[model samples]
Target: MKQRSSPSAMTDFYSAAALVTGGGTGIGRATSLALVREGVRSITISYATSAAEAERTAKELDSLGATVLVVRADVRSTGDITAMFDLAANKFGRLDILINNAGTTRYVDLKDLDGLTDEIWDLTLDTNLRGLFKCCRAAALMLKKSGGAIVNVASIAGLRGVGSSIAYSVSKAGVIQLTRVLAVALAPEVRVNCVVPGMVLTNWIERGGGGISTEEEAFRVAAATPLERVALAEDVADVILGLVRSKLVTGEEIVIDGGKGLTY
Candidate 1:
C-alpha cells in the first residue's frame, strides 16, 4: 500500500505495532488496511471463527509490506483474550494501538422481550461488552508503556436505542460508556475513543444477519438517510484511523451514519 503523510506528529505509525480484533472482515479489515496505508509495519489480527478469512486478510496485508500475525481468539473467553495479548507482546515487544472490533448479535425485535432470551442476552453481552473490556485490560500495560490509542467499534443502535435486538443495542451502549470511563482511567498514558456506525453495506447486513438484510431494504434505508446513502466499511475505518492518530482527542464518539440519526 502507498503510505500517506502522517496525520499527527505525536504518534509515529512507522515504528508502532497494533492489534485489531475481528480483523478478518468488515470494519476490522478496513481498519487494519488503513493502518498499513499509514505506514504501520507490524500488526496482529485476532479472529473468532473466521480463520479462512483471517488468513486471506493476512495475505493481503503481507502483500502491502506489513508484518502480519493472524491469531485465533474468541473474545468471549478470557483465556483466549489473554493468550492473544501474550502472543502479541512476545512477537512485537510493545503495542501502540488497539482496535476492539470483535462483537456478536442476534436478530430479534426490540418489542419482543420474550424472544430476547437469556441466551441471546448472555451471548451479546459477553461477546460485545465483556469481551471488549477484557481485551482492553489485557492491552493496558503495553499501551500505557507506548502511550498508545484505542478506538472501539460501537453502533448507532446504542445511541438510537434500536437495532437487531434489545440485547445487542444494550451491549453496545455499555461499550460506549466503557470507552469514556477507560479514557479517564488510562489518563495521559492512553487515549480511548469510539466509532458509532449506521447502516453500513457490509456482509453483516447483506447476508441477512443484521436487520435490513436485503438489497431492496438497504436501499430504502439509504434513501431515507440525510446523505441518501449507506456507509461503506472504509468510511468508518477512516474515522477510526483519524481517532488513533489524534493526540488531543479522547473519550469521544464519532458517528458514521450518513446523518440518518438526525432524523430519528
Candidate 2:
C-alpha cells in the first residue's frame, strides 16, 4: 500500500519493515529516520565504515520507540550484501522496503584520461552499479513475499555527464538503466524506482573529494537552479519515502534536483 499523501500524514506502516544501505549518513540517514517516524515496524540500517554514526543513529531511532538494527557491510562485496540482507530478514522476519543508497566515487578531473584508471573505474562501477544490482537481486525474493518496494538513490549525473569523475558519472548512468531493468524483472510482486538527487549538501563530496572546486559548490548549483536552492538530504529522503510507499509506481526515476538538471 502506498501513501500518496505527505510522509508525516501517513501512519499506516505498522507491520512494514525496511533495510537502508548507507544508512549512517546523508540521504540514507534521513530515509531511515523518516521510515521510523512513519511508524515502520522495524528498520535495519547498513553502514560500510560509519560505525559510530550508525550506532548513534540506531540509538536515536531506538529512543523514538522504534526497532533499529545496525549492520557493518560494504555493498562492493557480494558476501557482505548477502550477510546484510540475512541479518535483516532474521531480525525483522520480512522486508517491505529496500533503500539502495550506498555508493562510492573519486574526484578525478574529466579530462584526465589517465586518472580514470582501471582501479578507479572498477571502484566506482563495482560499488555504485554492480553492488546495487546484487543487493536488489538478493532482496528480490524477500521483497516479493511482502510485495515490497525499492528506492535506489542515484544522481543527476546519471542523467547528464556531469559529476565527480568520468567513472562516477558512467556508473550512475548504469544505476539508472539498472533501475529500469529491475523494475520489469521484479514486476507484479515488487516495485522498483530510483531518485536522482542533484547537488545535495552532504559530506560524501568532501569524503570522496569529488571533482567540485569547493564544498560550497552546492550553493553555486543552487544559485543556478530554478528553485534557487540546493537540495538537502531530507529533501531527497522525503521523495524516496513517497516512492517506497507508492503502489502504482515502478521503474520510475524521479529527479529531485530542484530544477538544477534543467540548467545543466
Q: All models: lDDT?
A: 0.90, 0.86
Runs in model 2 with CA error above 4 Å? Answer: 1-11, 208-215
The lDDT, on a scale of 0 to 1, for candidate 1 is: 0.90
The lowest-lDDT stretch of 10 consecutive residues in candidate 2 is 3-12
The CA-based lDDT of model 2 is what? 0.86
Shift of residue 140 alpha carbon in model 1, Å = 0.4
Clashing residue pairs in candidate 1 are none
Among these predicted structures, which one has the highest TM-score? 1
User: In each prediction, how many residue pairs overlap at the backbone (N, C-alpha, C within less than 3 A)?
Assistant: 0, 1
lDDT (10s digit) by residue, model 1, range 1-264:
995332322358999999999998999999999999999999999999999999999999999999998999999999999999999999988899999999988888789988999999999999999999999999998898888899999999998868889898999899999999999998778899999999887777755454445687678998889889888889999999999988889999999988888897
lDDT of each residue in 1-264, candidate 2, tens digit only: 974432222225878888999997888889898888888859999989889999988988898788988999989999998998998889888888899999888888789889889999998999999999999999998888888889998998888868889999998889889999999998777889999998888886666554555447866777788999888899998999889778788999999878876765
Q: After superposition, how far is residue 148 of candidate 2 from its true place, in Å?
A: 0.4
> Residue 224 deviation, candidate 2, in Å?
0.7
